[model samples]
Target: MSTEEFDPSRWDGRDLPYIPGEFSDPDGVALHDDYDADIDPVTYEVVRHSLWNINREAGETIQNLAVSPIALITRDFQTGILTESAEFVFFGQYLQYFSGTMDIFTKWIMENRAEDPGIEPGDMFLHNDPTVGTPHQPDVALVAPVFHEEKVFAWVSNLIHQNDVGGTVPGSFCPNAVDTYWDPPSIPPIKIVEGGEISTEKEDLYRRQSRTPQNLSMDLRAGIAANERAKGRIEELIEKYGATTVKGVMRRLNDSGQESIKETLSKIPDGTWRERAYQERSMTGDDGVYPLELTLTKEGDELTFSNEGTSEQAGAINQPFAAWRGTILSAANVLLQPEQMGATGGLVRQLNFRPEPRTITAPDHTAAVSPSGIYSNQVSLSMANSVISKMMLSSQDEEIRNGAMTPTSAQWQCHIGDGFTDDGEYFLAPMTNCMMGSTGATPKRDGRFANGHMWIPEARGPNTEEYEQSWPILYLYVKEHGDTGGAGERRGGNGGKICYTMHGGEMELGVYTTDAIPKTPGLFGGYPGSRGETVVLQDSDVKDRFAAGELPTDITEIDGENVETVGKGPAIELDDDGITEWWWAGCSGYGDPAHRDPELVATDVRQGGVTVETAESVYGVVLTDDGDVDGEATESRREALFEQRLDEATTVDDIVAGDEAVEAGGGD
Candidate 1:
C-alpha cells in the first residue's frame, strides 16, 4: 500500500496519469513555479506526505463550518489551505464531493487552471459541479492549497448543502430536471478571493443570483474564513515539523487507512449478498418505480460492490454514475468504518463500485437526479441492513432493525423575487431548512427525531426565533411527533416539526428534503418510518390567536392517523401513516411488540405519545385499579395477543392480497 504498489493494474483507462497538457502527476513534484526541482525524490515524497496529512487534518476539523448566514455553504475539494495552486477541478465526479453547482465549479476550475499567474496560497476557490467533484449542484465547496518554502504540498476542502439555488422550482432541487441549465444554485468557477481579499464584484454578483442573499453571503464568508484558518494551521505545521515529515505522515495515513479497510474485508464471510430496495412511484411522481440493487463481493480481503444489473429510472431518481459510485462507497465506509475519515482514505482503497449508466445511481447528466439526492441515503441504510442481517443476525442484534446510521435526511430550496418593504426599501431573501425526515432506528438506540444527514454531523436546526427576527417569516414551533418512530424492541427515531408565517414581502420559499415520504424501512419486524411534507398555513382565526397572547409560539400538528375525536377536529394518532393528512415523525421500530418491556410501554403512554387504548390493543397489557400493571390480567392478555400476532404474521401475504382485492372493489 505504498507509492510503489500504485501500478497499472488499478488503472481503468478513464483518464491518464495526469492532465494531458499539464504535468505528468501533479502530486509527484513541487507545484509552485519558484520551487527548486533539485530536491531528492525521497525528500519530495516526504514533503508531499506531510502536506497531504496537513490537508487531511484540516478537512476533518473544518468540515461542517456553518457560515450560511441564510444560505447553505461548505468547503471545496482537492484544494486545501496548505496546497495553493491553480484550481484543480479533479476532472472527475463533482457531485461525489458534496459540492454545489457542478457546471459552475467546472467552469471556475478551467478558467483558474489556465491562469498563468495561478491562484495564490491564501486564495479560496469555489465551485459545485457533479462532473467536476460534487454530487449535485446545490452543494457548495470552498478549497485552498498550501505551499511551503517554494513548493506546493497539500490541499484543503470543505463541503456544505445549500438550501437553495435558482432553478425551475422554489427549491433549487427540481426532481423533474431535464437539463443542467435548469438546476438552481449553480455557481460556475470564479475566484471569489484573490491574495486573501474578497472581490466585491464577485460577491455582489453571487448575492444577486440568490434569493436568500443574506444567508448565502454569510455561508460564503464562513467558507472563506475556514479556508484561511486551514491555511494558517498548515503553515504552522510546516514551520514546526518541516514539509517533508508532514508529507510523509500524510502518505502513511492514507496507506494505513487502506490497510485497516483491507483487514476488515478479510474478516467478513466471503460471498456475494444481492439485495434490492424500491422507491415506489407514488413518491417519485410520473417516474416509474426505481430500484437499488447491489452485489457485494469479498475476495479474500478485497471487497467490491457491483451494480451492473440495476435498471435506470426515467424520472429524477437517476444520478451521475461516478458520483453515485462514490456516494455508495461513502455510505458503505461510513457504516462499516466511521473511524477512518477524510475524502481520500482507507474506504477508497479496499472498495470498488460498478454503477452502469442508465441505472438510478448512474444516470445521464440531463436526466433528473433530484430523486437520487432524495433516496440515495437508502444506500447506507440498505448496506447496513445487509451486513447486520448476515454477519450480526445471530447475535443479540439479531436483525437489521435500527441498523441505519442516518437518522433524518433533508432537501432545502430557495425562491427569488422582487418587491418593496413596508418602509419602501427594496429587499430580497431566500428560504432554507423547511424540510427534513428522520432515519430508521439503530439496534442500540432510537434514531434522532428529525435531524440532519449521516454525512453531516453538525448540520443543526436554525434558531427559529432568530430566523424570524432576521427574515420576513414568523418562526413556528419545531417539535418531534410522538410515536412517529418505527415500532420495535428498539424503535426508530421521529421527525421534527416546522411552521413559518409569511410577513409582508414578495419572495420565494425554498425546500430541500429526502425521505419525505416512502419511509426509511426497518428490518426484521420493524416498521418503515414516515414521510415529510411542506404546507402553507392560512387562517385568519389562527393568526388572530397568534396576535393575542393566547399563542406565543408557532404550532403545527403532525397527524399520523386520521381518526377524529367527537370534540377535537381530528384525533391526532402519532403512529404510522394511515390516512393521515399532516406530516408526522418517522416510524422506525425494531423487534416485535411482544418483546417490548411492559413497563416501557406504560411509560410511553403516560407521556402522551401513545393512547391507553393503543397500548392495550398493541401490547395487550392491562392497567390495574392503582394505575399499575395488572400482572395477572396482563399475563393472560399477553398470551392471547402473542398467539394472535404470530398468526397474523403467518398470513401476511393473504392479508396483502385481501387488501388489494378490497381496494379493487372500491372499498375504503
Candidate 2:
C-alpha cells in the first residue's frame, strides 16, 4: 500500500488479527514467514495456550519485580507479546491503553530504526513519546526483539506507570504544563539494552529526567526482566514445538479472534451511538469548560469511532490518538469479545478510529498531554463505554445486550504530594485511594460499590497500612461515600472518599484531577453520576486531638480552614497543615430512580450505601423508625411524586408518555 493510496478513513480492520499494521515495507518483516505452515489442531491449541501464559507471566514478572508503588499496589502496568513485525499476539489485561501504544510506537520504531541501528537479538528499546503515539510520558515501555536462527521471530514488551518523571510537579501530571515543552521529556524508542546488557549511557540519560532516579532504575529493571522472561518462554516453546509451529499458533490465534468478532457483529444490528462528556478548567486560573464527544458507528461487521464534537487542542488536558483508540479497544475486548483472551488483533481489526487529530481526544505534538492519564483518557473511556454499551443494548441478541458494561473506571484523580520527612528524607508519591473508584451500572443489576477501574479489570487500591509504611501521612478515614452514585432502579456503584493529614512531614499536596462533570452516563432514563470534589482543611488542630488519644474519622468535625480546589489549576504551593478530603463519585445508574423498589432502598439505607434522606427524596421510598420499609406510605408517596412531576412539567406536543407511549410502542 502506497502512502498515496492508503486512507485512514477506510482502514482495514483485519491487520489487527495478526500484525497491527499493513506491510508497507518488508512484508516478510525481515525474515521468512513460517506461519503459513499447516498446523495441527493439537499443536495450535497447545502453542496458543503457551503464548497467552507467556504474556500473563510477563505481567507477573513486572509486578513482582517493580518497586514502584503504582505497579505493586494499583497494578497499573501492562505487558504484550508481538510478532516479529511488532504485531501484538497477546497483551496483558492490566491497562489496555498501554498495549495500544506498544503496538503503534513499536511499529514506528521498526519503520524508523530498522536500517540505522538495526533490530538485533538480546537488545531492548524503551519508549514513551506521545508524539510517536504514546498515551502519556510516564507510561514507559520496554520493547525487546527475539531471534530464531539469526532472524527476528517475536517481540515482548511491557509498560508501567511511574510515580514521577522530571517535570513541573511531582507524580508528573503537570497541571501547569501548557505545552509539551513543560512536560516530562517524551522519549521515543531507543536501545536501552544491548547484547543482554543494560546500556549505562542510555540508562543514565533516562534516569536523570526523573525525580526518583532510584525508583526509575528499579522499574526499568522490572520492565527488562519481564521482557526477558517472556522471551525465554517463547524460545522454550519454539524449541519444543518448532519455530514454524509456534509462529503458526500466533497467526491462528488472531485469525480466530477476528472471526469471532465478525460473527458477533453479523448478529447485532448496525447503528451509530453518540456520547458527550465535559471537563472544567484546563489548568489553574483557567475557567473555561471543555466538551469531548464520541460517535461510535457500527456498520456491518466493522465499527468506526469519531470524535467529531470534541474541543480543539488546548491547555493541558489533551491526549494523543492512542488513548482514544485504546479506550475503545478495551471496551470492545471486555464487553464484545472477552472470549478472545486479549488476542485483540481481531477485535481491533473490527474497529476504526476517525480521529480528530487536533482535538482534545487526539491532540498533536504541541499539546501538553502529561495530564492525559488523569483527564483526557478518562473522558474517552467513559464516553466510549457509553457509546459502545448503547450500541450493544440496542442489539436484538440478549447476550449482546447483557454484555454491555457501564463505566469501569470513569475518571482518574491524582492526589500527589512531595515534601521532606522529619528525618530529612525526600518523599514524592500518590495516594492511590482514588483507584477505588465507582463502578458503573449493568443491565442485569446495580453497579458494584467502588468495585474497580474501567480500563483495569483487576484495579485495586492499596491497603491503609501500605501508605503508612511508605510515607509520613496519616489517613483519617478511607470509607464508602454514600449517595455518590446515580439514582435508579438499578443504581450505579458507590464511590470512595479519603481524608488524611500530614503527620510527621511537611508536604506540598496537589489535586490533579477531572470529573468536574461526571464522566459516566446513566443508561435508559437513569440519572448521571455525581461530580467529584477535592477539599483541603488549612491550619487544622487535628494533631492535638490525635495527641489526646482521640482518633478522628469524620473530616467535618475536625475542620479548620476549608479550601476547595478547582478541577484544573496552575502550579502552586499549598498549605502544609491542610487535610486533603477527596470524594470521587461513582458510575451512572440504569432505569428511573422513583420506580426503584422500596425494599432495595431500605436495604441500601441500612447498609450505609444510601442515606435515608436520599432514599425518601430521590427514590420516593418511605421507611419506619425501625428501618423497615413502609410499603403503604411508599405507595402513597410514589403516587404523590407522580402527581408532583405532572404539576411541574411543561407541556409538550411530540413527547410520548403514559398510555400514549404504550400505543406508540414505547412501553417495555
Candidate 3:
C-alpha cells in the first residue's frame, strides 16, 4: 500500500499524542489538577506507595473476579492509574504494554467523547479498538474517572484478554485474517458501565460480538469491578489526605520518575543503535518474509525511536501505531527506569517515536492487527529491547550498564482448541503453555528457564490439570525443551515444549504462531537461538501406546506420519486421531560462545541443557564421558574453532578499502 493511499488521522484518534488540556469537543467536564497543598516528605512517601499498592491490588481484583482462563489463570490482565488527563502515573505489575496503550485510549476519550457521551461522575468507558488504542482487539479495557467533589480527579483503568470476541476463528486470533475487518470487532471507548451501575444494554452490546458471550460478559464485570475497586481506594485516599495533598503527591511521584530517568540518561554517552528482525509469512497459504528495523538515537537526556526501513503493512503481520509505540514503552519501563516502576508517563516524556506511517510498525487502521499482538508487535519488542540494551551498554557508569541485557524472549506459539466437552458444553481456549518462554542471556548470568513472556513477566499460564479440565485433550508431557537456548558466555534460558492428544470429545485445533527461523538476534557475538514451529502427527500410534500403559515424552518416540508443519500464518485443524506437539527456543545469547568457560559448557551438558556436539562445535568445549571438562582438548578445540572462524569470514578492512577505491574511481 502507498503512503498516499492511507491517512491515519481520519479514523478516531489514530495519530494524536497525549497532551494535557481541557477537552476540545466537550468543555463542561471539570478536571481537578489543583496541586497547591504542601505535602511533607513523610506524607508524600506514604501517599506515593499507597497509590502504587492500589494499582497492584486492582490487578489482583481482576484475577479474583474473572473466570476467563486468560484472566483467572493466564493472568493476562493489567491495571493502572492515570492522571485526570490520562497520563499514566502508576501501573500495576501486569502486561507492561497495557499501561502505555491505556494512556492513549483514555486521552482519546477525553479528546473526542467527553461531549456526546459526557465524561461525568460514575461513568466508566470500555474499549479495545487498536486504532483508538490497544495492542489488539482481544484486550478489552475499562476506565473509570475518580471524581473528587464532582470533578475528574483521576482515572482508574484495567483490561483483560477476553476468551473470545466474534471473529472468523476461535480465541479471536485469526492468523489467516484478510484484514482488520476479518478479525474481531474493534470497539472504541463506550460506556460499558454507566452511573456506577451495570448498564445491561451496553454490556449486551459489548459481548454481542463474542462467540463465548458468558466468558466475555464475566470479563466485562471483572474489568468494571477492578476499576471500581481501585477507584474506591483513590477516593478514600483523597478523603483522608485531602484532594489537593494527594494530587501534590502524585505530581511529585511523576517528577521524581522524570528526574531519575533524566539523571540515568545523562550519565550515558549520546549515540545511535540499530537492530533488525524478520517475520516469516503474512497470512495462511503465503510464503513471505518481511523485515522490521528499529533505530534508537539518544542525545542529551532524551531518546528518539524510528522505524524507517520497515516493510509496508501486509496481511496479519501488522500493528497499529499505538501498539508499535507500546512495545517501546514496555522496553523503556523495564530496561531504563524499572526502579520508578509504572511511571511511563515520565519515561515517555523523554522519548519520541518517529514512525513511517505505512509500515508494519505503524500501519494504517485497515491492517489485520488481531494477530499482531502475537507476531509482528513481538518483533518490535525484540528489536527495541536489543537497541536499548546496546545503548545502555555504552554508558561508562557501571550502574547504568547494570540495566542492560540482550534481546528478550519475543517469540510465541499456541494451539486454540474449539470443540465440545465430554459433558456437552462447548469450548474455545488456548493451550496457553506457550506462555513459559525463555528469557535472554544477560552479561553476567544465564537467562532464567521458562520465565514466561518478556512483555508480561508476571504471567505463568494455567497448570496442566487445568488444561485437561478446560479442554477436550490430554497432555502427554509439558517439559523444558533443552539445548534450544543460544550458545554464549552465558546460555539463554530454555524454551518449553509439549505434546498432547485427543481424549474424549470431538475437536478442532487452530494453530497460531511465528517461526523460530531467521531468529530473534542475540547480543554481542552470541549466536541466535532457534525459532520454533508447530507440527501435527496424524494417525499416530501414540494413543495405542497409551492403551498399552506406556506414555511418550519425546516427539521422536511417537510413531506417526507428519501431517503438516505450520509457521506464522493460517491455522490448520486436526481430528481426534491426530497428535499435536510443539516447542520454542529461548531468547538469544549475550556473548561469544567460544569465550565461555569450558567447565560451564560441560556442566550444561551434564544438565542436558546443552548437547555434547553443541558444546564442542558452538562453545568449543570438549566434554569427557563423565561430563567433565577436558581441559587440554578444550584448549585445542577453542584454538581450532577460532582459526576456522577467521578463515570462513571476510575481513571488514578489505571491504572498507574496496568501497573507498570505488569512490576514488568516480570517472570510471
Candidate 4:
C-alpha cells in the first residue's frame, strides 16, 4: 500500500487499509502460539499498568512543554500506545476522539511506509488528512515506531490542535471555504525522523505553513518529545520482560477487552433504535438544515450503525468518514465501557458502519471538511448517543440504563483574534474560554455546570486572571448564565457567559462558525437548551460606566453606537472602545419540568438559577414573598399545567393513523 497505490477518490470512507484481521473476527479467534505460550498473569498485569503509566506521562509531558494555550489550558490533545498491529492498547484520558485516530494513522504507516521509509527504531511519521484517518486539518499526528529484537513491537502517538495552520482564515477552521484546498495543506504520512535524527527540511516546511510558526514549532517539538518518552518507557519494559512476553500481554489485553464488550452487549436486548439530528448550514444561510440520521441495530454480540437517510455533502458543514467513525467510537467508550481503557480495538471489531458516500457523514474527497470537524463531529456523536440511550433504556439491565446521560451538545464555539500586545509584541490565538460549557443530565442527577467539554471532561478553560495577564484584554465579567439550562425535573447544567474588551491594543476578532443552533437537544419531555449568543458592541459606554464605578450585569444594558450580531464570516476589527460578549448554550435535561418538586424549584430560585416568574410558568412552582415554596399554590398550578400538557399531546394511535390525524394534531 504505497502512496501511489492509495486513492482518496476511491475511498468509500467505511474501511481503512490497515485494520488487523482480528478486528474483523467476531467468532472469538484464538491467539497465535507465541502469544498463548509464554506470558504469565503477573507479567501481563505489570505490562498493562506500565503501558497505562507511559500514556499518562506522555500527556503530562506535552502539556508541560507545549507553548500553545490549546494544550496548556484547554488540553485539546491526546497521547496513546498502539500495538504493532495498530490496535489501541492504552489511551490517555485527555481527549477520547483522538484515540480512534491513533489506530487510523498507525495502520496507515504500517501499510504504506513499512518498506518505503523502512519502519525501525527512532523512525517517526507525521500525517493529518481527514480523508485517511485524521478528524481535520488542524489536528496533526506524530507516530513513532518502537522495535525490540530488531522487529516492530509497538507504536506511540501524539495529536494536538494547532491554532493556525496557514488556512484561508486565521484559524484552521475555514467556514467560507468551498473545498479542502482552501484549508491548510494536507500532510500525508511523511518521515519526519529517521534513525534518531530529525528531518530539518520537513520540520521547517511544516512550521512555515502556519501563521504562528513559532507556536506550531513548539507544538511539533512537544509531540515528538512525548512520543520519544513513551518509546523509551516501552523499551524499558521489553528489557525487563522479553519482547515476546510484552507482545503476549498486549494480545491478552485486547482479548479481555473483547470479552468484556461482548458480555455487555449480550445484556442488551436485540432491537433497532433510530434517531435523527440536524446541522444548520448557516455558512451559506440558504443551504438549510441538513439531517444526520442513525439507525443502530443490536443483534447478539454485534451492533451495526447505518446512516441511511443523512443529507448529501453540500456545504462546509459536511464531515469526513473518519470523524463519523471516531465520534461514534468516542461515544461508545463513554457509554459502554466507561471504566476500561483497552476496549477500543475490540469495540471497533464488534461494531460496523454503513455510510453512503457524498453524505454529510461520509463526504467525498473534494468536499470541505475542515470547518465542520468540531461542528459535524459533535452532531455525529450526539446522534450516536441518542440511539445508544434508547437501547440502554430499553434494556432490562439496570447498570446499562444507569450509565446513560441526556443527549450532549456537540457544538463548541471558538473565538480567535490577532493583534499587537501592550508590550509591542504580536499575538494570534484562540481564547481558551471556548472550552467551558454544560454537560448533559443523567437519570438520577442534574448535569454538571461549566464542567469543561463533553468529549473530554478533564479539559477546562484557563482562569480569567491568567488569560488577561497573558493577552492585552480586560475581563468585564465571567460567570454562569442564570436560567439558561433546559427546564426539567432534573435540570441540565448551566453554560457560562464571558464578556471582554480590548485594554491596551486593537485586534481583529474572527467570526464564529456556530451560532443560535440548538446542538445539544433535550430528551423525553424536557425542553431544549437556549441557542448560543454572540454580541459585539462598538464605541460603547462601558469604559465610562467602569470609570463611574458601575459595571453592566448583562450585555443588553451596554450603550453603543453600532451593535451587531455576527456569525460565520471573516475577521472583523475591534478597537479599544469595543466590547464582545458570548453566552454559550447549556446542556439538555432529562424529564418533564412540570413534575419537578416545589422545594427544588424554590432552591433554584434562591440560587438565582431560576427567576420567580419562570418558576411559576415553566415548573409550575409558586414562590412566596420570602422566597419560600408555596406548596399548596404549587400543587394547584402543577395540576393545571399537567392538564394543559395532556390536552396538547398526541396519542400513539394518531401517529399510526398517519396524515390526516397528524395534520389535525399539528405534528411537524
Best-fitting candidate, scored by TM-score: 3
TM-score of each: 0.71, 0.93, 0.94, 0.92
Q: Please tell me which model should have the higher lDDT, number 3 or number 4.
A: 3
**Candidate-wise lDDT, in order:** 0.48, 0.79, 0.79, 0.76
Model 2: per-residue Cα lDDT over 213-289, one tens digit each: 99999999999999999999999998998888898888878778889989988888877788878777786578888
Segments of candidate 4 deviating more than 4 angstroms: 1-33, 36-39, 282-287, 649-668
Q: Which ten residues in a row have the lowest lDDT in candidate 2?
A: 10-19
lDDT of 1 by residue, 577-641 (tens): 11111243464566665566777767766764545675677667687655577778888988998
TM-score of 1: 0.71
**Model 2 — TM-score against the truth?**
0.93
Q: Considering TM-score, where higher is better, how would the candidates rank from best to worst? A: 3, 2, 4, 1
lDDT of 3 at 558: 88
Looking at candidate 2, what is the lDDT of residue 523? 83
- Candidate scoring better on lDDT of 2 and 4: 2
Candidate 4, clashing residue pairs?
Answer: none
**Looking at candidate 1, what is the lDDT of residue 451?**
58
* Stretches of model 3 off by over 4 angstroms after superposition: 1-26, 514-516, 651-668
